[model samples]
Target: MTRRWPVVLVGPMGAGKTTVARLLADEWGVPARDTDHDVESLEGRSVADIFVDSGEAHFRELERQAVAAALADHEGVLALGGGAVLDESTRALLADHHVVFLRVGLSDAVKRVGLGSSRPLLLGNVRSRIKTLLDERSAIYESVATLVVDTDGRTPGDVAGEIGKALGERA
Candidate 1:
């Protein structure tokens, strides 16, 4: 039988989805699955390396698979990759779950994620890419979000607590 989770966290690179998902899952006493980590585990390589080797198209396909498997096999807090929503299939899969859009402003995101690092997407023009991603993906995030939480100035604990409270209310 298939099982669904209570909350799925979706947002951009610096949105703290991975950390917050852990906090939420710890509070709920369940597992926290991050699709990027799952993909890394499955592929035996980092996402950046995968992109460098196989390219974004291949990475997206892998991400789709990882997201599908996690949604099917894991019954806990799940955090999707920032671009996971770019795939319509992934968006469709998220429609039935308790999806939380963890939003962060560009300045905060730049502060959190920085203009450097192994992030494949923002490798070139970090600021421009981040802005473009925010412009393009914001609506998709909003459309699929059952709840939206602005992560600006909030600690991960505070965000998790708010999510937990919202989950209680949702229940």
Candidate 2:
């Protein structure tokens, strides 16, 4: 039987969504795309620079467009930007797709990002900022995700295996 082969990965910036998505795509012999990379390519600027100059609304717009394009142009694993779920249009798209939410604790997220990564929302007061962002975004992720995987101390391969198992079951 033919199988529906699209997996959308959504989570916080440092939650290893991209890593896991790539692994899953490789394991499944499908394509992998990251929404942020798509945005940067289309906009001709880094996401950090866009946020620096035009504010988050502009970056979010680019992010939304990137997501729509990725969904339309690719048919495998897609890892969305951290704030992608905040956009209503993206959430609507996710509703019809298999979405996975990688849930990672604040401390682990902070450690993974390591006060680097040029993450705008995560700048200064890392712990509290992340906690607040998580509080705001967790519900949206939960609402859209068909499966939720906690990524604490888990390698990308392990996470991919979990997703593979879940995908097989769903099939």
lDDT (tens digit, per residue) of candidate 1 on 58-129: 999999999998888788899999999989998898888989999999988888998775698888888888
Model 1 lDDT at residue 138: 94
Model 2 per-residue lDDT tens digits across residues 50-122: 8998999999998988898887778889999999999988888777788999998888888898865567776
- If scored against the real structure, what TM-score would every candidate get? 0.94, 0.93
Alpha carbon deviation, residue 92, candidate 1 (Å) = 1.1
TM-score quality measure for candidate 2: 0.93
CA lDDT of 9 in candidate 2? Answer: 92
- Model 2: lDDT of residue 62: 87
57 in model 1: Cα distance from truth in Å?
A: 0.6
What's the lDDT of the predicted structure labeled candidate 2? 0.85
